[model samples]
Target: MNEIWIEKYRPRSLKDVVGQKDIVDRLQSYVTAKNLPHLMFAGPAGTGKTTSAIALARELYADSWKGNFNELNASDERGIDVVRGKIKEFARTAPIGGADFKIIFLDEADALTSDAQAALRRTMERYSRTCRFILSCNFSSRIIEPIQSRCAVFRFRPLRPEDIKKNLGQIAAAEMLSIEDDALDALVHVSQGDMRKAVNSLQVAASLGEKITVELVYHTTGMARPEEVKQLLEVALSGEFIAARNRLDDIMISYGLSGEDILKQIHRTVFELDIPDYEKVRLVDRTGEIEFRIVEGSNERIQLESLLAYLALVGENRADSAD
Candidate 1:
């Protein structure tokens, strides 16, 4: 099996992890002190939490870091039994290189049950001297209070477009691939501040050995290209509601696009449509509201259909008023 690009290209040191400068700076202080707290890295996926933790372990422990670091996924083994047993086994040993403590990196800690978390809390206290725990989760709220209280929490933000572009440009030069300017921008836009997604898309495009284009990024992300989305908008503007709705359904099913993904495409496509500036702004504002509602457990298909119908009405109104 081919190794996944995300893992293969994961940042090896703190300097290589992009974005989150404040968190990195604070972490550097901890490394300098040779005294680290239990850490809770709360952030969205693909934003370098795990990578930073591993990097820290490697930096602090040097050659024998592997034996001193234990990494586990809480979601994969969801019970306290495995966690308790592993911690018991790993924490029993002293640091191989005479460091103060070994490191245990627990990923997806939010997946643990409350009972499991309680058990984990006791484990943290019991092994406090021998092992430092770095817990990572998408949401900090799901972690139990006692567990949360023990750690220094760091919130990681999504990478900005500039950061993503800089990293992608570096990778492109190293991989010997040429990307069109617009295509690079499209990749950054589609990735939405996730560097891992940006790199993976770049790697896939590079494998094809062609100058990366906007259409390629869209296909790689399984979203309709901006041009196709604009085409659908034009059909809506012409008051061909049935045709436009049909096209939306076809695209969703063909590409497996989520409701949120469609909304993002619509938001971008609106600016490209030939419409009054005021109308474009108004439509996008309404689209944002509909997207929020869909995310909050509203029926996705119905919410999206409502958005399309509203766009069609606006388009028809503009046409009639113009006439």
Candidate 2:
């Protein structure tokens, strides 16, 4: 807790988790039954998939949780060979107590290859008597159907704004950092439902000074302030191509944003612009095309520079047509 907040502040029990109430209630029922089938947790990053897995293990195993709880990240484990090897090792022994089975938590499980997942599915069947598996993944669609059918899938939603704010307030009180009301709101907005990001931002901002402000939050996260992004779009729409290009370069270079990151901001900011509705739609569609190219490994700086020029053209067209 002294060194890092995310790990230190991670929820230890089901009740401690902030959101996903229905899933928590279901998990609590599993605890009461003293039995669990395979579980698949599907959601975006920074939600409580991993946390719920650990909390369930703790609830089930009491004093001997660590020995019975085995955690493996499928993204790092790579191939079927490694997966089989680790499962064999963990499942070899009976659980330490009279409990019916041990638990293996495979995090980021959607990263596994088809072959690897097929092998893992077999492993799950073979060990059904003595072991249970809980898989956590960002997207459940990638998980094979055989594996899906075996598990009770739970979809985790991103934390609500109030949930994030409550956690931030507790951490600030505990850590004794001074964060303003608006600054806290900004943190929540930037996190986009990721509690891990919100907590990390607070910790990073705290490192710079005792008083954490909105400016510090934006600077520490390397995100262009919303207004800066809005202004960049405004400049481009006003037909100042060179200045807008320079500003875009500064934002990407100074803020460490990928082309995708900058374009996402542009897409959102477009809706807030004074431009006509049809033109707003056109810019957003163009942003999507460029973003796809960047994702396919195009040169980011060149693509973004060209995008500014396109905006300049759109502005001129808007002026020339003169509705």
Candidate 3:
């Protein structure tokens, strides 16, 4: 529904799209002139590329925007037929309310195959005067060279931590939620520079009531509690191989901590440990190899156990060398 936080909080205009100043500036130029070129918006997920494209349409057409905009997802529709048919239907119709050209927004355009993209290139050229295409994708490299050449490419960067915090604060105030500074920081860290995720997390936390804490976000993201993960690492570093393996099994069973996630926590915890530089480097290298092997279809529990064994050895080695 339109009342959903993500949709409800969607930016209505260029200024509302956060953390993309340069892209906004270039897009503003097109809106000001009322004559936009074909555009390719490339960026990571939830970073406002689709939202910016919609905002641009809203600005350019004002009240008549709906009639002048056509939005489609290349990945959802599949193949070139749908794209060609939609482009023909939309481009054939003149801009509503006497506007010079209509706008077609293609989300996830990079999903189209090379052959489909070639067909899209022809359609783009044919409709250049009557319709402007705004293509959105996670990666620009996947788009065919010919289509990329025809469009003005705007790269959207992930929102910075400060930007995420600022926007989250605004949303929190609007929703009448009280939050602590540390909790907010935790949300930002988990979001990893994604404003949409931050907002969504805040909305979920707000829905539960006023007392939102960092642990709430940690649970929301399905990550094992930091304390629990820390405990597992500490036990492993104690050099009691059997006890360490038992603790790992308990963690995996109780909290569903996957091999990949355990590896990430181990990576983070390694830096915080009092180990020497060379030893830290060696541990990290081994951790990386285990991570890669886990990803490459090695049994998760087996690979992780092997990793824990290595950690135990390293901890014992370090303790002995220190002695």
TM-score ranking from best candidate downward: 2, 3, 1
Q: Give the per-residue lDDT digits (tens) of candidate 1, residues 50-112.
A: 989998888788888898999999999778786678866887678887899999899999998
Q: Highest lDDT, which number? A: 2
* True-vs-predicted CA distance for residue 56, candidate 3, Å: 0.6
- Pairwise lDDT winner, candidates 1 and 2: 2
lDDT by residue (tens digit), candidate 2, 96-175? 97778999999999999998999899999988888999999999999999999999999999999999999999999998
Clashing pairs in 3: none
Whole-model Cα lDDT of every candidate shown, in order: 0.85, 0.90, 0.84
**Model 3 CA lDDT for position 184:** 91
Top candidate by TM-score = 2
**All candidates' TM-scores?**
0.83, 0.93, 0.90
Q: Give Cα distance to truth, residue 118, candidate 1, Å.
A: 0.4
Q: Backbone clash tally for model 2?
A: 0
